[model samples]
Target: MYGFRFEDVIVDDDAAADDLQAHLADAHGGKARPLCMCTPAGVPMYVAKVGEHYVIKRMPNTGGTHAPDCASYEPPAELSGLGEVKGEAIQENIEDGVTTLRLDFSLSKTGARIAPAPSGEAADTVRTDGAKLTLRGTLHYLWEEAGLNRWYPAMAGTRSWYVVRKFLLQAAAGKVSKGEPLGRSLYVPESYSQDNAAGITQRRIAHMAALAASGKTRKLMIAIGEVKEIAESRYGFKIVAKHLPDFPFMLSEELHLRLQKRFENELALWDSIEDSHLTFISTFGVGPTGIASIETLAVMVVSVNWIPFEHAYDKLMLDALTVQKRRFVKGLRYNLAENKPLACAVLADVLPKPVALYVQPPGIEQEDEDALSKLIGESDIPSWIWRAGEAMPELPLPSHDSASPGSSLHRRVPPRLSAPMLLAQKEGPESAW
Candidate 1:
């Protein structure tokens, strides 16, 4: 069991609630104290008031300090895109017991209507680099901050879209985007239910009214949610997101085809991972009738554990590792239009260095070997691969010095093959990463 630290004294669970309240009232002026709780290993934590009680939350960057079985325990940040934007795209500032995040992405974009790209083609949007978060990175970051990416045996069967939507809304509060609190410019539809259907509808309309009021020079806002289905419509294609079941957004046929083609790999990965979710982030405008329609969009698949995956092979490996309670970080393709490659995932908390896992496409030709080797060889850290058609090999044990701290665990880009390099018999480059 973990203990709470009130200033210099440690208190056990029995006295934690009473003691924490007293400490805050006397020392911190009724505000949440910063890192007042410490784990057995001396990792800092904070007390969050839920209702009339306090619950301990792990301090940033110290999630690994908790025992794996602890409720507050989380996998290392290196296992997700969270590590990349910690100080760059996402900044956290603590003041007066409140934690606010200053984000680098813009919640609203103002411009003329964007034309739809041709079917099965990607538009040349801005690159994922620079200081701001990319569309894909924003989804990953939100999932991480909402605690959806962390799991334990106790959470089984209790998670749902409603719970996810609530947590995301809470997490996004006080987040700064484009010089304003993100909650003002962002809209996450409440989960659909018989009891709250009318309330949910009213809330959506009131929030979207701002966009609808923008008129011809409409301002686009960002929306994040699970993709339920995409199908043909008289106007074009309809996208039905999970939470907003009553509200299906319209997409141009040209844009729909582009999404299907560009996210083919993500779709396959989602299919292979049981209970996995396909999340979509889009810049959209609200119609006069309060209908939200997407202009620019991107989709990604996350495993049951909430780590994003790029291919079916990745889903298989992630499931196998997760069952064993091993921690790993999934890779992200920031620049979707680029032909560059990245690893499938990297195992964390291991010794000499973290283990980078790469999956080679099946039925490989001789030329593919050089490319595969070159990609894996780029990493100086110890690495392994699961070649197609072969059984997965045993992972290499971390060397004695593996636990040493350094920046070596950061993500690295892998080598990518162009569309023409793929064999005619296999899935296309877009779907078969």
Candidate 2:
């Protein structure tokens, strides 16, 4: 609720083994090899940055095509590699008072060609990476492990949904374990998570699944208060572990089911509403409807399908994904200032180009009231409420018709530029209209 502290570790896309191991050693405190598995039995596995291409070795007729479908994957600019990755520890990447971790993940060389079925197999067997990839733009996920439910109570509502989804992903990946999971996060929003942008959010989820399916990024971020730093290196890394507590695991299947059901129900409720809603109040006789309510007939403005969507998801991407219920107001109604940065960001993320919005609230300042009232033809009226019975505007009337031609009451003399108009000449008077 205060603020989040993250110490980022940047991994270059083209980084090799020495580059990665050196950083890991600093983070892992010269562990030579840090533990990379759920149960730390040995030093961590070495994630050697191998060459870009992959070759399938046919161990004597044990294989067929090099690739039944696609060949080597060329990673996009986003996840070709990382700037730096720690050895499954938070303190290794600490900066200031907080800590952070990041990595450039790529589609690993795990896929191999699908060989022909043995001579006379019943069905045409298929062979491909069990995970199916989709063409979505961006995706954001809120996930956690079944074990960590003890630490993060807010996940009680949606634990079942994730557990089930996690189970299915693990089964497909042909691996499942406690403590470790396919997708998870240290900070999961308390309420439902949403992804307004279709492609990006989905792609992000897919990318994470790719890691989980291929057995990578298998690390967890420990809670700060729950754990303590035991040691630190000269290069500012801390050796840490959980400060043991008497309480142990008691996460129930019933609770998990309840949470999953509640999450799904909430998601169904959200599906009922669009991204926007509009409420307008008819004031004075200005609206299309002739009858105006004294309290101003409320006009509800809604952002429906008609509202243009952005190529990338809007702020809604961050908003929709939550683990628990929260008191979040919809739209920017609470924003008092005239300038709308939040609205601007949301619109820019959705709209192709920039859009502008202006809001006019009730009330007028004393200084500009006179000028404003003059423009509205109510110069004589004084006060805030300009009802129908107020006084009308004042206009000058003509004075004695042509009695004193020199003195024009209706038309004031202009400031001199050319020679002034002569009303009447001494000998022969000429009247100018």
lDDT by residue for model 1 (1-433), tens: 2444556665543454466566544433434343423234455555444334434444556655644323344444443345545665666543322344443343455565454442112343243342556666666666655656543333345556555665566566546665566666666766666877887787777777678665436666778788888878888998899868888878888788778787777777666656888878777777768677787677878766455666677678777666654545456544333333456666654542556777775766776677657756655556778885899887654343322232112211110111001111122211100
Q: Which candidate is the best by TM-score?
A: 1
Summarize candidate 2's per-residue lDDT along 1-433 as a digit string, tens digits. Answer: 0010112343321346465445544543432332211121311222121133211111111111111100110111111001011122111211211122221111122233221211111121111111211001001100101111011112223323223233223221211123232223211111123333344334433333322332322222111111122223343322122221211112123322332342342233334454432211111110122111111111111223111112113223223212222111111211011121122111111111111111112353454445434422521111122221233222111123321333221122221111011111122321110
Pairs of residues clashing in candidate 1: 79-329, 341-414, 351-402, 352-402
Q: Which stretches of candidate 2 lie over 4 Å from their true place?
A: 1-32, 36-132, 136-151, 154-268, 272-433
Q: What is each predicted model's overall lDDT from 0 to 1?
A: 0.56, 0.21
